[model samples]
Target: MTTNEETIVMTPLWLAIEENLLALEGQNITEENKEKTVQKLVGELDGKGYAVSKSGIKMMALRWALEDMLKVGRPMLKDLTKALSELTLEDLANPCHASYRVTDNLGKTWERVQKTDRRDALIQMFEEAKLDLLVQKAKGLDGDLGIRLLIEETVESPVILERMGIPQEKLDQVHADIAAEIAARNKVLSLLETVEGKPDHEKVKFLFSNDIPEDLIIEVAQIAQADIDKAKKAMEEELKEQQRLAEEAAAKKKAEAEGPALEDIPMDQMAEHIYAIREIQYFSDVEKEIRTMCEQSAIPKAIVDLSFSDPDKFDELEKQCEG
Candidate 1:
């Protein structure tokens, strides 16, 4: 091969990866896109007279991405490590502050937060943790080998094997596992749909809430011959509009039912009507409003007094009223 020809032929798959990344513009990773990327790499390599397998090229591209992540994440990882080491047990147990700070690739700083009960310090640093460990281990290896290591060491499933073109040793076993996973996923879908009487929009929301795979929702829709676009539109747009309309209708109904302004009512009539408060179907979330209305009116003094004397009872009433 001529010098230019050899250079072109030897060019790494990272170039293709960079192009794909640029095209994606930081979009969420998807299996379809990844497959298309591999096919594109295959075509590009073919055009350059390089006879590389799609799987092999994919592995190289994956490694390149990981390498970049590791490089960028190292500083963040170090900062996190230092901060974590310095943290006292009490800080981990119950943080008083809203958030702490960390520096990123651009030397721009951002706060790391752990929300009450819902988020943990370690959980918030997951990206940094994953990149730090994987990159540190793969740094010494070549692109293909590094990606192989990542696949082996990580919790990522057999789909990675298919993507990397790594042959499954127990092919039948792999098939069985895949079948089981699909069955389990289907069971989840059925339970969410049939048992719960949830429509596709709500079902999709449930799946998303559980962090179930988007592909599974797509698959479920396909199996049922449901229009995925319509289901998505209902969840994203139609359902939201319906909810908004319902809220507006409820507000209108409430206003109409409120009868006359309290100012228009005679004090004796208002006192007589205040007995209707005892018939409240459930406790209300409008705590401040309830408190003010009760406090200013002598007729509802019992409810206001209950808020101070037996606050737990009032709290229980509030809990029971939740939708």
Candidate 2:
């Protein structure tokens, strides 16, 4: 029969057996129960016209269980081999069980009892699953930072990539590329720091002189200009505050030298001065003293006019006070 025709005929049988095996998952199969379970599977397969023996059913079940265990992660080979040895089927199976050999990723083979072809197929499946997981992890990572972390991990545990099938020459090239990129980025950062507070043109010139990339130079220049703007604003505010303080000091010194003007003196003190001026003997002396007091006291214009027009009003006020 042709390969395609055989595949079509065998497909349904494989599916039926797999369905029955799935039902046995999570069951506590012991020495007493294992033979009965295997016989039941054999009978089921026989009724389906495949006619597989009890031993064949047990081996298929063990292969299915091992495949399931090795699906997601790096399962230890020794653990798997130990579990294989402890199975109830191991005690019941024929002496050919001792011929089984399991080969690990490290090229170390453990001799046990299993068919060569089946054991090699399972080992291949495990390696493929591990490679698929590595690919998924790689797909999730991105950007320079992601690349840096990936490079670091590859350097620390190179076996990880080696198992992924990466060659040494390719790995060396990747390392060279990473080093060049890191060196360029560090140079840009150092140049940015050195050009701080410099004029925009000077910063741009300095970056160009260092042979920095145009895009990076633009970015760093903008940063430098922003810092300059911030410093200028701070200096302007400080200068304004200093000018205000200086003006206040000058005004205070002037006030101390000249004394308080009449407007600055209290109204009650102005009243006292006016009453004392009225007590001067001569009219001329009273007028002169009143004018002099008005000039020094800086009293209102209305009060000054009233004092000159009717000097006796203050005399009347003094008499009222004496009374």
Candidate 3:
């Protein structure tokens, strides 16, 4: 591209002129204000770094505006035209217009046009408004901001759909769809509220999984209240019994690990134990163990050694073993 084509110069004077000239577009000028208008244009261009004639300023502004229109407004115009053309005369005549009515000099009025009209009068106004808004944004703005202005106007068909119009049949379908959604939401809400007060029982879970209605679940919950209570009490009792068994077992194990104490037994029985320890291989050192037993029982060594060496000599040993 040429340097002039590649670069954009946005000095205050050219911008002011461009803005003023754009504001004058689509006006029906009369001879009375013609000279005044030209003078105003000349005055706006007078105080700039460079001097330019009134005609020159007007030409450049118009060119810039036109270029912007082609680059941005044309695509938007095409899309909106498509949006408008989609509407039938039936859509335009829908009493719904009372809601979207555009008001003006005559008060609130809805325009009704024939299906075969050569031009859609309102579309022209819509296009011009959108076009002017985009052109305003194009001034001294570039990249995403300028591009965004255009993109924003090019809204998808899903939005502004009322402007494009929909048939009564499609409206009915939408109504049915909305009803279904609301009903499903209500069911889910009811289920959620119901489940919160209920237990995580398999029966309740099964009922929910099968999509049983809330009223039925409420009735079942009433019948199962006693059963649920019974089940919970039974579970707690079972856990307590298990804990009792564990404690009893632990006590038994501790008692078994610790043999009978010397003070807790009589001398004769202690003598018999020492005799039994002699016969059993449980004592790592039999002689030392017998001595410890003799001292703990306060029995004489001679007596213990005799009893441990000859179990038959202890008369009580036979009866105790039998017992």
Against the true structure, candidate 2 has what lDDT? 0.53
Assess each prediction's global lDDT (C-alpha) against the native: 0.50, 0.53, 0.48
Q: Per-residue alpha-carbon lDDT of model 3 for 1-323, expressed as tens digits? A: 13656855444443354455555655544557655665665665555423445456555643443344334423223333444444443344432341133322112111212112313444444454454444454443653344333334563324323432444454445446656656765665566565565554544554556575545545644436555455556657878999999999998876544545534657676657656555543544566776675555555444455455776865455456546
Tell me which residue pairs clash in candidate 3: none
Q: Show the lowest summed lDDT stretch of 10 residues, model 1.
A: 109-118
Q: What is the TM-score ranking, best to worst? A: 2, 1, 3
What value does the lDDT take at residue 77 in candidate 2? 41
Q: After superposition, how far is residue 116 of candidate 3 from its true place, in Å?
A: 19
lDDT of 2 by residue, 4-119 (tens): 55643443443455466556656666656766776676787676666566356645754454344234222234444344444342332322232232233223322221334445
Candidate of highest lDDT: 2
Clashes of 3: 0
Report the lDDT tens digits of candidate 1 across residue range 176-197.
6656777868766665665366
Between which residue pairs do clashes occur in model 1? Answer: none
The better candidate by lDDT, 1 or 3, is 1
What ranges in model 3 sit over 4 Å off?
1-73, 76-245, 256-259, 279-323
